[model samples]
Target: MEGTKPKAGCPRAAGRVGESGMEGALVWLIYQRAPGVGRRRMAQLMRTYPDPEVAWRLGKAELAAVRGFRPDIVEALLAVRKSAEARRDAERELERARRAGLRVLCYGTRGYPERLAEIPVPPPVLYQYGPWEPDGRPVVAIVGTRRPTAYGLAVAEQLGRELAQLGAVVVSGMARGIDTEAHRGALEAGGTSVAVLGGGADVCYPQESAALYRQMRETGAILSEQPPGTAPRPENFPERNRIITGLSHGVILVEAGERSGTLITAAHAIEQDRDLFVVPGPVTSPLSRGLYKYVRDGAGLAVSAAQVLEDLGFLPSAEGPLHFTPRGLTELEQRVLGWMGSAPWWPGDLAESSGLPLPEVQACLTMLEIRSAVRRLPDGQYIRIG
Candidate 1:
């Protein structure tokens, strides 16, 4: 929301695999292949030499003269530049990416995510496997343990659906349990979602999510900083968490134990100065302990996706969902609320009037009551409140 939208009629440079774009991507791959040149070092190199072609042409002495380029790093870069094998490898990687139909986004490119660029040491190259581009929309990340409880799964899915319905992009690691549910909910609502993988954009981890991965590729996106053949190693996940939080305007933690790795994403959210929202779970569950600490430390308590949207300033005001009406409410809930006014109505009567099932009408009333958009009278009748 802080950045301006691209001017109308201006063409986007992202996803354009033109000759110049491919050449820039090749330079990034060459740097990535060098030993001891990690993300931070690569970022520093890009800062010193904004043009990869220029950096590629620099002699060893000139490379060594650059600030922060330690002797070993300079030697590594020089060796990588001269190695025919490294060049071949970089070329082979590009070929593989091309065959897979992946879009390679180089750092400082027009196609790169603006929010991600604001983070420290953003990925030098992002491999994207879908069509969803960042257009300054509200992107919120939902993350939690892979082995979540029933309650955690339900909450994650509900939040995902609600947020998607509000026209926000949902992001997650696409791991098991909560992450999978989040993606599923977003897709089910016919809304955009993105999965930041710990491995290659072409690879689907856990194997169980193969179907979900396909759905995302068609509807949302699969993103990764890793190359085409990279596997989802354990160490890569901690690093991958940074990108998850970096790409989002805020993060929602549904459930995590005391030492859950999900906390890594939450830490990155705080470090990156993004809003953090904690969903309160059962006090007896170990999964709720880590989140409670964040809440105690003043993280926003997320009872619903509408609350998150309002807190992040995505909503017009903080008066509650009903004030905005149809924006946050489900179709059924909207219809049910529309039928109610100052006069109290029973669930059966409302269902008959709206031509919906009694059970569904009852469920809608329950949700509306929870949202404080409607009030239940002593005689088991409901009336619209806000």
Candidate 2:
């Protein structure tokens, strides 16, 4: 036995196959394949098992002892083990990433983002390439509609440029419209900007953003949680949007409609307890409606980069344009606030423009009204009080 090669059935033979880091990747592969197993559940399981190879050694009953493990999950786990195709597929992806100059950061790696680790359920394994230093400075996420109006584009560009000029890293999804404008504005200003991709970091989504993506890779960085070579799927975008928010100190909603996916990103920001800012948009435009609702609901109104910088404590209280005491409300608060340069809006029109249900729209409006921040018009509309 001492001179003989170990049998294939031996535990040591299995151990000889994959080493520690590679084993972790394989665990992630199996975890990814397990139906209904998401990042959070995988995290929970990993916390308990800590060793992927060991976890794989467990029988159905043993695995069932883990929380969140169900019969279907057990079956999925077993299936993943038996699926030679999954192993081959993962190996191919791994090799592809190696050839493409991409690196992966599985959850328990040295290169993982520290801020992301603080979240309740961080991604199990994050795929990324290019520069990823936090640089010990606050990050701000600027996002908006994929199809922004000219006004929206202008605000995104101006804000991004100014924010970068001031030393804050501008972050966005690199989608078209506002996101693209934000990244471009920052880069044009010679500032660092990060593009969080919905697909693999190596795979550019909007196709038109290829140039911008290249610029970011050169000047800043493009990051994603998906594996390298993974194509953009409809579901992956929203999930990646969460990471975009998670990595930021605050999120600026530029020109989102009520149902815009950008709002979902904003929701993730709120969930992360990050500061929320919204640019005022014309009530006449559906694009600005979501922004109006946010402004009414006590989100910081970003009229200028100075205001945002001041609110985030990035600047001394004394550094911005003179802070004026807000004037009390009156009947014409509607007409005047309504006409205030197409930046802000009233609630009724915001709802109509944003296409959000009346209840959600009213909820935002009511909150704004109670704060004396917005006045209700006699016409049953709401406008910013200040």
Candidate 2 ranges with C-alpha deviation above 4 Å: 1-23, 46-65, 78-83, 315-386
The positional error of residue 326 in candidate 2, measured at the CA in angstroms, is: 26
**lDDT computed for candidate 1:** 0.80
Model 2, residue 242: displacement in angstroms?
1.0
- Scored by CA lDDT, what does every candidate get? 0.80, 0.70
Write model 1 residue lDDT over 58-151, tens digit each, in one string.
7888888777789999989888866777777777777778778888776655577767877877887788877898744578999999999999
lDDT tens digits, residue span 270-365, model 2: 777778998887788898877776677778988777677667644321222211112343433332333322234555556565566657667756
Clashes of 2: 2
In angstroms, the error of model 1 at 156 is 0.3
- Model 1 Cα displacement at 195 (Å)? 0.6
Report the lDDT of model 2 for residue 205.
Answer: 82
